[model samples]
Target: MAQARRELAERLREGGSESAALEARVLMEAVAGERDPDPFGRLDPDATARLEAFAARRLSGEPVFRIIGEREFWGLPFALSKATLEPRPDSETLVEAALDCIGDRRQEPFSVLDLGTGTGCLLISVLSECRAATGLGVDLSPDACETAQHNAVVNSVSERVSFVQGSWTTALDRRFDLILSNPPYIPTAEIATLDVSVRDHDPMLALDGGADGLAPYRIFARTLPDVLAPQGIVVLEIGAGQEQDVIALMTQGGFAWRGSRRDLGGHPRALIFGYALK
Candidate 1:
């Protein structure tokens, strides 16, 4: 059994399914009470069965994060469920832009509003940086709200971050110092054409950006101004080539162009806008 397990692990690696080996190792360790296994010793029968099931799912294109039910974002591990979209590294740009906009303003207790806050990763990360900050994360899905709340507690920022379920900023009663969003910006028609990992796994509500792929931007531009404090900033993650159109929508809705930022590949990935002039 020991030698057979070693052969299985090596074959999985050779088949270009490296995660299978790691998953098997973890399961065997749990079953055998060895943090680091010796000679790939015997795995509990039940544990081996579970590993096989997980491997089947993984091999069929399920994300590791989904299978494991956790993902690391901004150096924090967040619990994930089907209700929330998987947090991606690109969204970190929104966090960075928000912090930069709040520079040296720590004296004032600022309120942050995160639209479409999935898993609370963005809001939690920001609140972690600005101890004086309090955040409200809103999502349309109740499951997402629950997931976000769980993440807040996990990150030890439950007192500073609150999760609400709603569409847009309709439920917000007070103006916020900062409002940021990485809403669905993928064009409706283009969604099906995306890679299998994205198309099959990610939630459609988080991906469909409407016919023009700029609908959410238009809505945010219209509604955020009302909820944003005077001179406050709003940063949005945009789809590729949608920057100009998004800026136009912001202008029409009375926002000022504060400038744009690019992702690691130099594409215009995030847009920063200032609240309308009084």
Candidate 2:
């Protein structure tokens, strides 16, 4: 195992991986089916082959989580599919903001709606933290909706959560106390310029944000009001430097910017909003 790690690390380093040693360790542990594998343990022939395949995929610009087919969000595991975006740590700001807004109401029968649900990470994570909360995750892709549903079950939140294939909030006939979304906020032109791991592995539907990259926010501004209950809160994950642009769009739709939360990088990544009239 030590020799295999050294060899994999060297190959990844030569392939331009910045965190070759760490990635090598993770990949090794994954193949060994444990978080803490015995460094002296021997890999079976099949495990060795799988490790090689995973390393090759990573070297080809696939994200480690993408190659593993799952990612941890808010400390919960979420399965990924071609139609779904891998749950990212940056997006966890939305969950934190949502839970903060739901504070005292956490134990109540809170209702949540996650737009562009993807792996249902946002809604599921919120539901997991707020034990009595129920949530609905909506996405345009049937495969994404299916994958999200499976993730909810895996997270033990299926009974409190549901997923649907639909556009934004159009299919909803009721209002929700909280709404969350990590929409595609990347400009169409910028998609090609993104890191190969993102441009090549993430679904275009989950990355392209139209010509200006704010199309989804525009739609949410115009439609979210109708689906949000009075005094309800909406938390959105925005790209770096998108705070004001998104705030302006939502403001035009009768929503007021409440505040913003920064990601680990200190970039304003989560925008909080509430009905202007309320």
Candidate 3:
């Protein structure tokens, strides 16, 4: 097994994979269908075939997450859809921020709305922490919406969570006490420069935040506040170096920039906002 992993790792490294060892381990475990202490041990023909296929896909620049079909976020496993954007560790920062902002409301029967809810990670994660909270997750892609629904079931929150297919906040007439979004924030030019794992596999609809990476924020600034309940706050994931610009856009859109949150790398990755109560 060690030998197989080494060979796979060599293949991945030669293919420009920065996380070759990690990717190799992930693929081996996935193909073996469980955690095997001795990964190099003999495998059934079926498992061996699966491992080769998985390795080939990885060598071609496909993400291990895409090949594995799920990612863990907020300490919970979320299934991916054809149109779903694989959840990232950085995205967990937004979940932490939302939980902090809604500290006292965690146990309350509050409401949440997640715009551009891809795998429903944001809404489902937040809802999991808030036992009594109900949420509506909206996305432009119906396929993504369905995945979110399944994710809700997987996390045991489906009873309190609902999925919708539509643009941000358009399908619902009600306001929520908490709004969360990890919208597309990569600029058009930046998209091409992204690592192959992202640029090639992630659905473009979940990326492409327009020329400046602030296009969705502009739409968010204009639309989100209207769906927020009195005193409710919004938590949005943003691209690196977009902190001030996003704050400015929200301010101009009639929202008060409450605060921000940083990811593991200390990048200002999430912006908090609230309606100005005009």
Top TM-score: which candidate number? Answer: 2
Worst 10 residues of 3 by lDDT: 31-40
Compared with the true structure, model 2 gives a TM-score of 0.98
Give the RMSD in angstroms, all C-alphas superposed, for model 1. 3.2
- Residue pairs with colliding backbones in model 1 are none
Candidate 3 residue-wise lDDT at 21 = 91
Which of 1 and 2 is the better model by TM-score? 2
TM-score of each: 0.87, 0.98, 0.95
- Between which residue pairs do clashes occur in model 2? none
Deviation in Å, model 2, residue 212 alpha carbon: 0.5
TM-score order of candidates, best first? 2, 3, 1
Alpha-carbon RMSD, each predicted model: 3.2, 1.0, 1.5
- Backbone clash count, each prediction separately: 0, 0, 1
Q: Distance from true position, residue 110, model 3, in Å?
A: 0.4
Per-residue accuracy of model 1 over 146-169 as CA lDDT, tens digit each: 999999998889998889899998
Question: How do these models rank on lDDT, best leading?
Answer: 2, 3, 1
- lDDT over C-alpha atoms for residue 1 of model 1: 42
